[model samples]
Target: MSRFASTLPIASRAIPNYTTSEAGNPFVDGWYADPDTEIYNGLYWVFPTSSYSYDKQLYLDAFSSPDLVHWTKYPNILTTADISWAVKAVWAPAPISRNGKYYLYFGANDIREDGNMEGGIGVAVSDKPEGPYVDAIGSPLIGEYHNGAQPIDQDVFIDDDGQAYIYYGGHSRANVAKLNEDMISIGTFDDGTQFKEITPENYVEGSQMIKRHGIYYFMWSEGTWTGPDYSVSYAMSDSPTGPFNRLAKILQQDSAVAKGSGHHGVIHIPDTDIWYIVYHRRPLSETDGDHRVLAYDRMYFNDDGTIAPVKMLVKDNFADGQMYSWKTYDGQWTVEDERLTVAETAEAKAMLDTDFADLVFEATASIDYGLGDAGLVFRATNLSTSCDEFQGYYAAITSSDRVVLEKINGGKRTTLGEVDNMIELKTEHLIRVTATGYDIKVFVDDLTYSKISVTERSYSHGATGVGARNTAAKFGHVSVQRP
Candidate 1:
């Protein structure tokens, strides 16, 4: 049984634009939150792949949240442009800070083709958590050890003796190597070898090592990240640098709602001794492709050290009165009752405009009308602008089901990218929009509705609100996220 009480009504919200960059490739459709999290300067930092590109070319991006609701994007900390070997993609960064310096372990690839990862593991260091971090030796660390097929997705563990170990790899298999006291170079083992294959089975990758109650645990993501089989499994051992024994599945796809569930990192809350697992899952929109969303669940260990699987639900104990938390949205403006509403007039719009731009719960709204129709709007500079020429700044959902990234430049509307049906906001709905890339993405809700992008004219710079067309409708659930 779990030691912590499960709570509901925790708030959730999407990270704002300018915090994340969209990938031109649809495979890496959006930002993927890191399973592992680190705390520095009293704030929680999450590292995720910024966009999909060739291996060694993808860079690692960071986001910081004080209360895990309203997140602010820190500048790009590690980029391939900074390293000669990392000219392709830099991904899945697991970070640890020691002796006043921070170490970032991540994967890099040299291949650009789809599904082909000619990658290796590398490390970078920085003095500050949010960094312009530099590579320790400007090269791959695994190259100094064994010449395996390709190693990546590195996780670091510091033992009670202060010895550091790195577990990394993907397609071929996962391996472990010890690091010298500097935490940069590989250290020799008793057998005179610097690296060794930890697990004989090829059933894993994305491995994270953690120590709890005198037992060392090895957890990894199984199956392909983009495919339907993605899941999380684990093993255990007595040593920090393990020859671990297989354990049962900690998380997997048990329901239609949560498929392709894997890529996890674990964190123990200080003082409370509570454990939380940070992982990603393919949302319903993934039927089109694997555009993943971040999720968390409270974790518990049995007396024998096995972990219970997580439950899939819209609400949980993490939901606070101030943060917006919702499992899914249907694209119609909705209230707490989950009923859809429309905004045909200003009075109806006023119902959504709140003093803060944060949502505490999740709901959706839809419009039946076709052309010349508007959906929901939030953080708009001005709501009174003519529908065609509206400016001031807002993230609006359109009848097309595509998020419309609208910005007012010189009182004119500019568009970014029509992000297709990345989100299913309606049944046969005209459009839906979600804020991305300092703009909005628009898509039609129908099965045939594709993705569209729209750029914002200016920043509303305040408030959480909604909008609609001159047609008729109903709306409710003004979800608010408070600090």
Candidate 2:
């Protein structure tokens, strides 16, 4: 069992000026925590819990980056909508791909006791990395907390020998179990029991394991979750299942920048020795529990194979980002080669899962076919259920070269501002919208076209994406920046 609370956080040596841009630190615009990073198809994908309250944390979003710098949010990849047994408290998802299928191991509805699907660790599967993954098993894989381990914070490690194991627990306890080849359920030992208790001393929660050079690096988060001293420590072992002796801490808080940094996942650069730790931290300015955000920095190894002090990246800049859609509506759309295209000329729209309250979104759009009007969408909500429609503000350019600004609510369209300024249909033009407070400003190319200020906060914070009414449009690049 974990020896936390009574065990003080063992701090690391000071790292000099670990810093990055704010937009890069959080990785996404909203609150996200317990991030697990995986490299697939030459892109880095981060799956994190929607850092909210128990009931509100019903969905999980993913971010993809070509480099480790910029990320595109893919929201609602997995949610309570797909799991029949899970209702809320979806956290710490472990994703692995094998046999042409992507398996997501997650903890939901923190099951204090035990029951059918009342809340425990479960598995979901899909064919793609960015997936609308469905529950692979009909019920919680570990529906009951056996051996005093809490059925939460599951992490999966596939060893070099093709053997996979799941590590998890909470309340200062952890357990490990072998996974069957299907990866949907657990395998049993000759004794015919479930999992074995492997909780190391000082472990609190966030069980993550990584094997490097045949050494098992078993790590866990320690300290009270909501406090400034929340940090991470680890133990090393020669075997996956081990009598791990507690090692020194590699990550903790820097009072000068941020605090409460822990619950991390390690991503060793494909075949290189360069390692990075993907974790969450509380920004120095925010004192709330759900104010956590994801961040990454280099994790080095010492001469003796012990983990060196992690250089945690710190940023104080404002929120800004670039995002693309993972889902689309009745439009023939394709997102490849850094461009988004509405291939068919009919009423269709797509929303990039990155939500916002007040920010600027800019995209270069050009019409390729049909007499169609296409624009950018902002503050979009009710994305998954609304008949492929959403509610938000739309800044559009008509096929007749007219600039238009409107509001969309449940498929009902209302014009807010429109200008007769003509711009070529098939020519690429820069479209930009700045929504600050209640005022909305629309721009074409570089000039201000139409502006409107709304009184109602009905759609205060949602997502941003692209839309077209009756035109096939192609957007070269869409970017959102905080101003």
Best by TM-score: 2
Residues 48-95 of candidate 2 have per-residue lDDT tens digits of 888988989899888776555446667899999899988889999889
RMSD of 2: 13.9
Question: How accurate locally, in lDDT, is each candidate?
Answer: 0.56, 0.76
Predicted structure 1: lDDT? 0.56
lDDT of 2 at 98: 90
Worst 10 contiguous positions by lDDT, candidate 2: 1-10
